[model samples]
Target: MEKKAAEKRVQELHTLLNQYNYEYHVLDHPSVPDAEYDQLMRELTDIEAQYPDLVSPESPTQRVGGEILSAFNKVEHKIPMLSLGNAFNEADLRDFDRKVKQAVGDDVEYVCELKIDGLAISLHYENGLFIQGSTRGDGTIGEDITANLKTIRSIPLRISQPMTIEVRGEAYMPKKSFEKLNQQKEENGEEPFANPRNAAAGSLRQLDPRIAASRNLDIFLYAIGDFSETGATTHHDGLNLLEKLGFKVNKEREKCTSIEEVIQYVQKWVEKRPHLPYEIDGIVIKVNSFVQQSELGTTAKSPRWAIAYKFPAEEVVTRLRDIELSVGRTGVITPTALLDPVRVAGTKVQRASLHNEDLIREKDIKIGDHVVIKKAGDIIPEVVNVLVERRTGEEKEFLMPTHCPECESELVRLEGEVALRCINPKCPAQIREGLIHFVSRNAMNIDGLGEKVISQLFSHELIHDVADIYRLQKDQLLALERMGEKSVTNLLAAIEKSKSNSLEKLLFGLGIRHVGAKAAKTLAQQFGNMNELKKATREELTAIQDIGEKMADSIVSYFENEEAISLIQELEAAGLNMNYTGPMPVQVESISSSLAGKVVVLTGKLEQLTRNEAKEQLEALGATVTGSVSKKTDLVIAGADAGSKLTKATELGIEVWDEEKMLEEFNR
Candidate 1:
């Protein structure tokens, strides 16, 4: 094709694809079949590849996102993404209504929307092209997640009119997408996400845009950020303008002339909320007029003109028939309340997590007692409170077991932790659970070996430990129930594939005490290999930043075991990887700076960094950052609405700096 022809074709395809994407993803209508869309996308991709310079940033092909990011950069919100004050019950909504009426006069109208339980994000458009997108991090400054946000097809790459705008929206994972994603995770031997909200957040935070693209994330543009340039008079008008500009505006919104109508909308949605494709935690009520919003203004964190009415979490009364105990991979004994099968949060509930023994005693939960049960979406069912008034003399006080239920070993509670644990390394339950963990996603990640299959293998004596996983033969796998020829082949292939995993995966897979995924990665990156890691003393281990005394002790203890050493050798013999293939550990610089060589305690909401991200940046600058306040704390980097740590810092008369100061120092 000629250059002129290719350019015209590329631009045409961009327009066509964007239209189709909006129709399918936003409007739930597609004029073209998926195959037809794919063909056009393929044509566009080819044309763009042939004429790279002709491809614009707003091209539909750009939705796949660019190259992988090293780390997310902080972006300052031009207009702050203020949160909404919450209303839990009818009274709270009425109070909010009365307050709004007082402030904006009796002629106020409100817009009610389903408050989607997802991450809040800001999308910036320049000349109608989507230029940037960021998270609602601390309501002021947020992480630049442009690449991830671009992958959400529902977000228009370019609007109809050439206009500059910043829009606020909820980026969410649909219920179907969430379920599919979790199923995929389980199938891949990975941990499933807790809910749609978490799945969406996790998806959009991926360093690789390809990961986010695969997640099928969608967004609902609710409010216009700094709509001064736009001729939108009301919140409802802004939403319409957004939709007209090809953005996915949720249709499940209503304009109410009175607070009574708002209350009715909230109540109606309280019943209708569960049926939506995405989770809605609450109904958001906002004074319709932008003038009224400006009049009411905002607090430091939230807008006074708006209030979100959260549905009281669904609670039901159920009989706690008995208490059950189970041992985990780490040998921790966890208690569960086996209840009379009852429905909570749309799912049948048979068991509720009792947490540890301390919780049971604290709650004074008794067997055969009627207990209030509650669950919010995919969250685990919990005992809200025991119905003490309904309890009869037949109710028996539940006691925690002194011994491991599976191994019959005497359980001991570790210092600082609440649960009783079996410290015996050879306990069958621990071994089984550890084996499962070894094949888990953050570890070696051997697929096709789910809980049922792992349990079958263990019970049949085909595997005793993580090392035995490599020794399993096809015949042994074939002997298990439901093990077909293809499944056996896939399982064997997956096991073989896990051998190439990095040293960090192996370290985490070992299930070392007090050594979590992050610590394992740290240790692997520090030592670089199994041999070097095993040689490290507790002192040497503790010398590394974030490698606390407990973690160091655990690492040394794990390495000191003869069986552990033998297992490493066996893994080596089976051709499992031992060297860390990930990035080397970052060395703390000795150069002088405001934060250098200082003991810092970070508190409250950080605008620019996640807690780990902050710790990493500070550590890189040679700061010994700790979690809590103490006499040794040199500086406290207090953020917006800082809590007890900030108070403790004030009490200690420690020098304090806000996020701005911290960022300045970080930049320096």
Candidate 2:
């Protein structure tokens, strides 16, 4: 009887979890608190662990993402997730209505919703339980992010009823959360995320679900998969059903009888979007009836049954006062435009990026010029154009500096690069910026070592180079204002922990020019150690896949410098890892010989190998795998419903292969 009761309990837990998953992933309505959902998941996990036989493939406990995906595995979507036609104005919306009328005749109602500014995701539910969640990558295939999706509190662990359904929604970061995250990043001396959308995408793509959970992401369900399960027959009714099932459907959604009403809704939100805590790029209008939608059909890329009405780009005019030059840790002089205080989107704008001397010349911007500024995507403040008519004759033409503003040394513009750089490694400005970059999140990721701390350290003559950071004593740190014993201890601990970071992170932290995180990882993997990387000739470095001529030159030049070599020796003396452990396996020599210097794209699922595993194999074989499929792509590994990429590849006559062929050729 006890065994029977245990089995029943397991079954009940599974049912409850499925209901929650459906409500959250499909409907976007989470009835329970985050803590409560977490508790349930824990309980389910415990049960599954206790009685391993009771665990099934559809269990909610299975979604906690495991194994750092070296790459994303492709999934062939059963239905193509097409894009929506865009409506820029009310007239465009009316034209859409006219088209709908022409196709389906009169009597078509509309479901109007806030078009969330986020990455689109599709959730597959089986028997009213959440099974899998994937990105809408090219519509036909997507990366499986089931674990990351599960971490979102708004996603349910289970559904209320037994039914198979597919739901689509927008996963976004709240504006408040974005601000908080950026603040934390800034305080830690890390580069702020570009915007909430990018933040959300970055968070969701993390290998660790715990990291994603801490990001405070939210979602809003917009549409049902096919509309056959919900018998109500209209888009509005389907939304209601989704809400009833515990999904977080958009409360702002409305049933509009006409396009005029939809336009009013759009207008209302355009003015009010900033007031909300989340970002919405536009409004989506869908034909109410499934029958009407079927009649409207779809275009090659988008659907005719629905249209997205985009809000006009938010712009505000401000005055450009003066251009200020700031030197980075790498001795790059960045020009910033000091602006008269003006309100752009929701934030007060006081500065804008000049980009480079080229941009200044292109815009013909001058000191004391009245400029029209706008936040690009409501995030970055940039001077769009100068109010040339308003410019007085007294305005002075800003001249590019021949010397470094900080170090007073000769500035050099490298071949094919725009920014004029200060080659002096010992420049105070460069030291401060380089130190900040060394402790940045993508690099060593040292917490509590901020700009103020670095500045104070420099001012007091406590440290000179990156290696000096490790030599900092607690008593010395305590001498600075606001640095208590505990804070000093924490800072020291973080710095010490950073020493154990992988070779890739160290490579990035070194501040090599044109070498980003991806490039650093690639270089680390290829060379196997910093010592090997330092000894590599320009010819040897350029021979590596994705290592362009410019990058090779930069690497060679950096290593050739006595200062750089001495710094590396000092860092090695500080007990940092100077060798690689070969995280990714080396590919067969035969495969490496053939695919050398070629770009390949992996699409769709491989039955035998995980996407990450495949990526490692390919990378080891001297092939570069890019995320997107382009005309430059030499080969595409097509696996089931390869989508537009496959179509384009065929059109371009790019070589295509299946998983079986890939496995056979690569000997995986």
Candidate 3:
């Protein structure tokens, strides 16, 4: 009788958990407090443990939480997670409404919610417990980020029901959090994150849950999938049911009885969005009835039942006081518009990148022209379209300089490329930028060696070329600002450590034209070492996949240069690795597997394993680990809340495996 009673309790817990999951994931309405849900989950887990026979496959306690994944395994989505059709203006919205009306009749209701400006994620829940989370990568596959998702405070560890469900939502960093993070990064002498969206995206992609946790990410579940068993006749009812669960739904969501109401809501939010703590790019409008949505169906890339109404870009008219030319590390000469101070997109706009001479000519922008400027993606300030009416005859046509701005060397525009480049290897500006790039995170990854330190080194004549970095003495470094004995030692140690890094890093650090990180890695791996690469002719170089003739010529020319030869010899003499060393070995077999081909995402905090170690282990095993969870993900290794990825995965019916099971498979 006791056994029977316990079994009955488990079943009850399962049902409750599924219902709550549906409420939270599908409908985005979580009714219960997180604590109560957690308590119930603990009880269910205890009951299941006491009577192992009573535990079912769909139990809420069986999520992927026990062991942290060494890395996420990729899963290909059966169905592509297509992008939404956008409604940029009132006319577009009206057209969308008309289409919906034509398909589902004029009586269709609408649900409007903020279109979050972070990463789009999918979550999968089975039997009411959170499982896998993924990014919307190419809509077909994405990295599994189950571990990172588990760290979100608002995401529930378990659900209230035993039904399998999938939910989708936007994962975003609040504006306040973004600001604080940027402040801290600046204080630490790190480059500040460009925008809230980028910050959120970057934070979510981190392999370590601890790093993700530090970012303070948040989410709002919006849609439900696999809802046939729930008897939710309409989207509105499904949302109501979701509210009864334990998910965090956006409070600003509204139900509109008609398209007019939806438009009104969208309009209202466009004005009211500035007051919100998070960045919202637009409003998502969807048909509220499941029947109506089915009737409306979908297009190649978007659902006919829903449309995103993008807010008009914020534009402000400002005077172009002067045009400045700046040379980047890559030797690309960019034109800058120094604007009269104006605020656009909640940020002060003082300068904007003109991109190149072609853009300047295309826009016909002059030094004294009154222009309208706006921030694209609310991050990069750009001159959209010139206010031609405001242009005065005094506005002079700006011409690019025929010579290098710094060294006055004759500039040459390479064929097939737009911008003119200064080929002088010793140009002071280019050298400074090159040094900074060499020590950048993606390059040598030298800690404590930043732009300021490089500048100081250059000023003191302690370093001129890239090889000079290897020759820094302790006494010389100690004389620099903020440098002490310990700091100097640490810097030296870092420099020494970087010397042994794979040839790919060294190749990237060289700042060769058109050779990005991936290209450098490919070149290193294909050639085996710098010597082989330098010996290869242009024809041999271009034979590799993805390397074009232009890239080949550039690489050949760079290697042929006497300065480059000297630098390589000096670096080789300093004990820097000049050849490819294959991939890093797996620290333990438990992290390597056939799962290497799969993309894996880690969401929540792990009781064991650092995120970096896990990523390394996975990579060594031949798997590609990505930060975002998308449809292409093979599995979501979830822990805790697991946020949007968990919801999206469930919606897509993707399989989610627990950490213990993953470990067992790996061991097997």
Who wins the TM-score comparison?
Answer: 1
Q: Provide TM-scores for the models.
A: 0.72, 0.70, 0.69
**Model 2 quality (TM-score):** 0.70
lDDT of 1: 0.84
Instruction: Quote the positional error of residue 33 for candidate 2 in Å.
Output: 16
Instruction: Please give the ranking of all candidate structures by lDDT, highest first, separated by commas.
Output: 1, 2, 3
How many steric clashes between backbone atoms does each model show?
0, 26, 71
Candidate rank order under TM-score: 1, 2, 3
Candidate 2 error regions (>4 Å): 1-107, 121-166, 202-217, 256-268, 295-304, 341-348, 377-379, 389-403, 410-420, 445-457, 473-497, 500-504, 513-526, 542-554, 580-668
Error of 1 at 260 (Å): 5.0
* Model 1 lDDT-worst window of ten: 583-592
* Tens-digit lDDT track of model 3 for 28-106: 5788877878888899988877888886544666543355457766755545565676787888988988888887677
Better of 1 and 3 by TM-score: 1
Measured on C-alpha atoms, candidate 3 has an lDDT of: 0.77
